[model samples]
Target chain A: MIDHLPYGVFRTPGREPRCAARFGDHLIDLYAAESAGAVEAGGTLRARSLNDLMSAGPDVWSSVRRQLLNRPPLDHLVPLSEVELLLPFEVADYVDFYSSEHHAGNVGQIFRPGQPPLLPNWKQLPIGYHGRAGTVVVSGTPVVRPGGLLGAGVVGPSQRLDIEAEIGFVVGIDSTLGRPVPIEEFHRAVFGVVVVNDWSARDIQAFEYQPLGPFLGKSFATSVSAWVTPLEALASAWTPAPPQDPPVVPHLNDDPHHGLDLRLTVTWNGVEVSHPPFASMYWTPAQQLAHMTSNGATLRTGDLFASGTVSGPQRGEVGSFLELTWGGTEPVELGAESRTFLLDGDTVVISATAPGADGGTIRLGEVSGTVLPAVI
Target chain B: MIDHLPYGVFRTPGREPRCAARFGDHLIDLYAAESAGAVEAGGTLRARSLNDLMSAGPDVWSSVRRQLLNRPPLDHLVPLSEVELLLPFEVADYVDFYSSEHHAGNVGQIFRPGQPPLLPNWKQLPIGYHGRAGTVVVSGTPVVRPGGLLGAGVVGPSQRLDIEAEIGFVVGIDSTLGRPVPIEEFHRAVFGVVVVNDWSARDIQAFEYQPLGPFLGKSFATSVSAWVTPLEALASAWTPAPPQDPPVVPHLNDDPHHGLDLRLTVTWNGVEVSHPPFASMYWTPAQQLAHMTSNGATLRTGDLFASGTVSGPQRGEVGSFLELTWGGTEPVELGAESRTFLLDGDTVVISATAPGADGGTIRLGEVSGTVLPAVI
Candidate 1:
């Protein structure tokens, strides 16, 4: 786990899907990775990128992630200086889970007051909502806010567009149909983790989020750091979760040591606000994986399963401005900055890193994006 | 609309992702679907055929989908001969939704018994799960039945893969960030619809479905009709839904006529067992669109959002064999067929057609596949 390689795609500018990762200064060609037996068992990186081979499901992927993590510095392989990171592999589906109990209760109290725990099924299984994959973009990319009708009637235009900084897990080596991945086996199947900022628009959401939930407020554009930090590398940081208030349904839960020791924090314009730890969640990622598979749906590589807004109980600890502002009521004060939601000039940074035993953070970089005027 | 040109990416022999669909005669070269116009649209149809585009969403393609639908003659787009069909777009993300109240209530009653109705959220949004987009084979493709362990532990190896014939929608534009898609604008952003047979293995599901939903049992394989009918062509047949039981939330719903008027039905072997209609849905597609957007999630073209299994209350009128078998306690009776679930070598067909004034069906053709034994 010593070598630092940056994963990305290259296309001679405009060409078919080509896989490459960054070494100290150049792209570590995945095509060569396949050919050299350094990646896939069968040479030729054809299914698209490392992701295609990943969707073949865990065992195969685990082996690769493990091998790559322990490989020594390939001083002669390549350098990062010669590469340009294209928009990472197109994400087919994004399923973000509300596994953060701290967030659930914190958000619940604000909205339901007395009911700050969770739904009966919340602790029992991984409750997830499928999100837009189209908006997922590579880092260093600017976010363009979209303009949509606000309120029921089309009167004027959209005003509030905010940002949500969080972390996401990418699935590699997907499971075959009907074969539910055992919680323990789930670990072996993971490809990597990346920092994801689920940018939002609180104003558009306020008017329309009742009967359905969230629409137009989210789908416009999303940004993600391109590097995929394999789960194997983050393994040393694994931690168990605190006991839940009520026992989960027997079918959906597992052992307590299921939580990953990942540190997630959010910053708006470089100001730290939400610093909730991943262990604060009642449900674990394994449990979430188990719950998601309960319905016979297949999980694939390039599948973006996010840990929904990691908010805490504190006001500034809110995951998104919508929660911090309490549905546009409370204005969040940031040093000299004050706002109920995100202003166009604001930049949100979502960084996820696992603190190694040496006390150094193994950061997966960060996904930062600035809001531009709405694209009409 | 005019010339009916159905597209796909397929060869005459290979069955990997290159198999072709069968149209009137000569295969419409997938290479040809690579339009000069699509390149201008900032998208390409470089798929080996429609197989990749149909399944490889996120890069929703400009092949002949819109051109075929807008042509008018509806029949002149056929190539020479009567036995050739190329490939369809590779569909990357396959999502199936449970939009039917009748189906939900009926399925729920099995576990809850006298439960009054389905969940309130069901009526509000289009709840969905991600499916295996990688295995979306072209029409006339053979399907391998998945086998798995039963509940508790392994009783023995069993062959109980079942079939769930569903109607699915394809997205045209994809969103990022947590942007919510507006309900009223859902159609404009949709590419088309295809009849899908969401294959399932209930037996394996029972054993493996716990913390998570079904994984291996259902991830095996799926079948879809060869040709895709564009969304615009179906607009004329669109119809309003019946009165709501628990009125919908404002933002989540739309005009009464938003639901499509497709006459969807499923057949096992040669027997017509279900006679349900699309209008029987408790929630409209608009609500599903709105709910999906509520979380500020974006959608992309080639992204499939399916209406989960549709079923009515009657004994034999259920959409899926799962309900008819009642957790495998009852055997479903078809004309000459009596079955609990699917069997190896068994064939299942899902056919959908819009009802014309003369009552004939404006068909999107059917998706039929035969189950083969698992390789082991």
Candidate 2:
């Protein structure tokens, strides 16, 4: 059986938040176990949030996970359905990177038809931009469609609402303010991965994203999986990445095992439509972390950086509606439903699985959200 | 005389941080004063940071200022030179807005010639993007030049480092997740103002700021004035904003006094270079705040959003080196030293003054940074 003890924050009806570890379909209450002298990891498990455990560093992270795995099920064991999950960590800064070549090529072709597919700097560096950290929510939170200045000078509800399915990496260690974290040491700085649904308002983004980057269009709400799959648990999923086309700089170059071989799936209204393969991504997480710190930007414990839409080569591998529908030129048919973009009352879910040590699959959980009408 | 009590965090050699306020040229230790029963406004002043005071709302903010103003000289008063100033508040989210018409026009002209001076959506919304909050430092911090992928397929030290002098506003009260804060209620949400130095790597920005916005080019460092001048203290500085060509929506359109009439000045080393007038900005701070939450994005207590480079429609009113040197076509003569962009060991300072109650100028202090050589 796969031994993936992903971490999360959960709570009962009116109880304080507690650190939890998932085993099969049940959750181990770390707080109650620690108090009962059954586990002796640290007091960090007693914290109301996962950020404290994240700040305890990788050594503690490993010890805690191992201890949680070896312990027998006590009376503290709770069913997953009985608890409510919250966002795993407090985000210090949220950054989204455009790393998938297939997604970038499709976006570039749709936006600029006659010109080159990717921008000149796309291949040279890991292109990213900061996003609203406070707006990030846990899975199951209802997202209200944003209302802003759309095209045709209309100030009303977003006409082109969409979702971007991607993988998000969270930082568990802080880096020095003026030093760069090399690609090899990315694991020391990063903690784990989660599924992220980067909600977007295409019309608002198109009209306002000129000189600056996307703001309100993507800031209203961004949903992330409540569970954080620790890096150590996913060791078996390590695989060789594709070779760099032009050869990246020395700082971005790393060992081939730095790449992850996860399979990501996006479902709309409970129907699977996209199966973007994480193995097809050109840039690895190690390279993304190295490029992020290359300019001496300090990394805090709760910082999050997401891999941009993970689209593969096939038609059903597109991650976002903009690419899946080819800029609304085509409509994606989901059995009895046909959609160009998302509509009110529509639900989107994203999940992923990685190779397990026993030749099985380690589920990374899912981040799901339903779109509500704009509160205008 | 104008008695402005700006708040900051400070500490002696071997002591914990304490809250303090500046009056004239001396800083009063509010923590010590509160302990000594010298001033009685609220318990928020006893904290180590200004965040607690900011969350205390406008009434508490006014009372604390008034109490500090009327108090007699305390024995805990320290000279400004002897105190170590830290960042006034913990930044939850940092956003920089392009609100100045002249700066936007000059940048547009230099970047895209034979096109309109401003983008089509310029006047429609306050264009802004999230920035790295973890890299934001206090005034006296030394900023290191960043190394990254530049043009010509070269990845090395940045050749064109620059600064954008701007005014920054800090949010005190939080807005609901899916609710918009009306323009008239902006004061209830915003706490204070401070001077900000948005450092830039022009070459890096030019190369990577395409499909996404600025990343490594601007994430290395951002410096801010240590002391935060409360908005209630600058009551008399309110002035009428420029009329909109096509009137804005009801949510953004507000009373005339929503404008701030501050005069911003920039200096290189010790020589005067530019003076950017805040009165000429097209959008007001209230309107910016309203637009930011228009899409139902939540606001946290320590959120900071800065006014973009405050350039006016004149030669000497440019705020950034890019415009002052006309995209490096012209060189700025700082007395005996001539430069196109910021050089290593060069110090840039930005300070401002606003209209006081007694018809005199009230000092807003300064935000200064010395550029260190690239650590490549």
Candidate 3:
């Protein structure tokens, strides 16, 4: 797919409202196609903004997908340079999960030598936490550093600050309270994917984490990629996962054949890193979804979930700064760059793709950002 | 403590402004106490709504505690039966943690075999998620289940549900961003504690857990205790923690002098079932706090923390019904109440007390509420 396609609310600088997806140097004006009867299956795509298209559900997403796949190219698509990618959807809610076995195990080794890396329940479930979606900003939006009130007992109060690069997923439609969508069918609930940068502070978390978990240390700004890649386009690349060790409790385990094969990698300043396969995880996304929903809560579209620190065991494959730097004990060398943790002006880029054995590849495009100086 | 002090604001039949806390049988009227020099160290207690007192910080809370703890002979005390316990503060942030080791391990065992109960990162850092504080209501306030568009298929729908009883701690002071407050000294940022009822819908969580942790399922509305307990009262009961299995990394470990042993119990319809002690947690409150600040985020007062499921290995000690009933397969039988999970009209009460090896326990009182049926 050489087309530079991006989902966004498109309107020419001097024209009426329209929803369009860009295709390499060109725009596939969805509204124009719908009006011209070229996109008949999903008549609902004729809306002014993508909200209607997004809310119309996955069937709409699929029908639109089919039309895009078959119809001859339309001339209405403006040049990629002529249009702006108005973020396709508003973030309803955001939640993050710590699923990186490399991260979990390494940290585990530090505290308890030779012990199993993850908690038993982790394999059975998708361990996750809720996040602030209102603060979820599109990539390119500048974020101001957040400040905190500190006790000035001895040392002059200010402490350490940091940043993290992680992948986030978006939900398309949600389920209601009384019914649960089964695990085998969870992929239908997925809307697309985004890149997330969850910034943090080492100081505040230490003090407040005693009885509860993180509060102020994370409530600040979080950045996410604007485009969401639909689950359908990526469906053909499904792959089986590695056998789970010790086995997942029966109810929580996914069918052996089930799971996605999204190849992901991060580039620091331009140094390419591992695009480890999702199959490498000790746990699968299906297991995580089933376990998360066992309690019967509803999921909504435009919601974001992060695979917190998706690091693998290899030192270079670690997903986040905490795992990459080993709590800042070792400095990381990214090609021409060498640093302990995320430093000012550092830029991190992450992207995911399904690299087919036959060389056909479909991917969740790159999410990149540059860190600015910490706000005083 | 015998005073049936219910917190609320009221006036005799048709009188002017009035605010009071349930104390034994007498309502310690703030209006009355302020005029009597009971609420002040200098001259007199200032008569105002509970809102005013909370915003004033430690000084006001100190003076009030002094008067309440003075114990002026039970015979001379007034009964709280005639007064109301008004809500005293507003919550700015609601943060919940899954800190119960029993809960962590039990669930872990189900998913992972022979693995350590908690993850390595969990010990070195605090795991938490933030929630909207606007939905937080004081105890006795009925919580309304939220409504949303949900489904697995783009347009399909569901109504699965669940519930959780938890403990909430209230922050008293505020911390700014980029500053770290050591866990040992985090208490100064705390104002007091409260009980919490965090309702969940299992169905919704399943479909949407991957890209985000929690959204509509946890965000709808969360109930919390209204009375803010001062940290000073719980100070005497704060004790060291039970040792961790694998020692934590040096940077994360504390001197072993300070983890509080808060014995907690929860019941559905007044029968005790979930009985996990805070002592069983792998990470202490101090450690959780310190982890959050490691990134330089600030801590603040009035911020609330919810302990994620506090389940232990024992049958009756499982924190949530999802754990106790094994995702609702094993029906949990209370004294005469059989609850596979929480049902509409079922009331869950969570009570916590600090056990002193040498003195009486400091308590966080209780968070109680009945599960109302989902709005059709």
Candidate 4:
């Protein structure tokens, strides 16, 4: 926990939300620390959201981190259980990228039978799309099963509710409009990482995603972890990315060792279902960032881009139930029960950890959600 | 202009940005009026953007309008040329909907030959997707031509730069996370409308849009009019939307007369090229709202959803150059020049008008932008 000082927004009873940093079993009140002259962030620590702190740039970020690491403010420490966690940052623009070759191939095989497993542009670029940012909630937020058109004239609650276990990168700095961010500037442009669970309604998505992309099927809810692990904390987690067969554009070229070696675990009803390897991702976060801004889309503070669904080659390593169950043909066992799609009250938890600089495990915050019955 | 007192944000040479209202050739300082006790909007009028005022709900909105109408604040009126207009609202989540049947059909014929123009679920629901909210700028902002991958390993400035003349609805009040906004609550959910120019890179879009949707092709920039015409101002503009071939789901069914009878004119380099009839749109704004939130997706205060492109039946009524020129095969005359796609110096202006309640023409603010060379 000392090495992984993730930031979050928390509020005590009857108090306004403020920024904090997680310690062993307590939280450091950043605003109080700043007020006491124990740290400096130019009044950004007093903000209700992390946007201002993030926008203060890397110099301020490192200075505050060093100060907190050197001189611990023991008086401002509050018990974790005494405060309520809120969404860490205000999301500017949310993008979900299908960067995992295994996940994309499985979805392609299931969605379009007899067609190629991968699209023509899959290897050439990192494919992604914008998502609803307002619905990005913190962990523990109950996800009500969304109601949508399952088929033509058939309106009902989603029968194929599913979850996508992925990792998201948070942008902390603003980029010039119409200027592409190069791959080498990933660390300067991005602040931290968060575990994400992009809830999906497969039935509705299949019926509507054609000329356009997914809308209601995905717009309903997207849950993210409250804690944001700074990129500097993952210094020892750098691993080589998977090789690309067809060479990419020159603008997307970069050192291949930019991938983070985080291991993600997905648990269904407290039963560990899968362990997804982040090292197996074909597209690195740097490449994704470069490709995202290749067309000169401006990056704003609090912009979030997820590494789609993390999946490996094996059946047990898949990130989504649609692939795990082979599109509902098979059911995975959950405790004593076997199920296909999510049932009401079904809970899913996704947690991850990376190699620490001190040769220990550094935990990225966990994101968990429970499916509530639809408000039909 | 009295009936259409649209709200905007403006700043003098050295003053801070504040809220204002558009008059004939002058701007009414809303903050000054509120301070003088001539108008009431709480303190939202003093804010830098229109989000607070819009979030104050319909009651406050109508009350302020009544006070401003009943008594004109003659002293605070500033000439329009003396101030610089800013983006009216801070966009929350932007959703672009394909509501024009003619635009969809033309795109289908050009992109997917031999297939049916309309997809299977086209008539059953309004197709929409989330777009980049941060890139949405105010009118008169220069658009730099974006560079993207045209083919495998081929990267260059976009050759098929095009414009989509659209009308966007701005959400005022927010809805609950798990609760859907019904069709009847459209008036309560929406505040006003703005003219939009959704810039596009057709060549990049054709290559990249596969399983997901348009990403870099359309995320570069989306320009909107500075002034926001309140829904109350379009009292007599209500017209019947085009009949749906297959009846929609009950959730999407709404008043057929909810469509606005707007007349949009498109100018390219000062040449009037098209007159798109907004009344002929297949799906109304009410239907778009109902479908967008049917899945329990929450709406935020600054959420913007636009009518994709307001193309009608005739060739001269199309909204995009891709459709009007048949995918760059037929060029359109612009003054003494001809073009299939936008040139570096080409300027596009999209303005619209609706029938006023007092039997006169009410002008919706115009959105105009000029194309600048790509920053290579």
Q: Which of the numbered candidates is closest to the native, going by highest DockQ? A: 4
lDDT of 3 by residue, B308-374 (tens): 6655557776667777777677876788767675666677777777743255555565767666555
Q: Of 3 and 4, which scores higher on lDDT? A: 4
Chain A TM-score per model, please list them. Answer: 0.85, 0.97, 0.85, 0.99
Point out the higher-scoring one by TM-score: 2 or 3: 2
A324: Cα error in model 1, Å: 3.5
lDDT of 3 at A54: 62
lDDT of 1 at A159: 69
Model 1 chain A lDDT-worst window of ten: A148-157
Q: Which stretches of candidate 4 lie over 4 Å from their true place?
A: none
Q: Give the TM-score of candidate 1.
A: 0.69
Error of 3 at A221 (Å): 3.4
lDDT of 4 at A362: 95
lDDT of 1 at B25: 52
**TM-scores for candidates 1 onward, in order:** 0.69, 0.98, 0.56, 0.99
lDDT of 2 at B17: 86
Give per-residue lDDT, candidate 4, residue A99.
Answer: 94
Error of 1 at B200 (Å): 9.5
Ranking of models by DockQ: 4, 2, 1, 3
**Which candidate do you rate higher for TM-score, 1 or 4?**
4
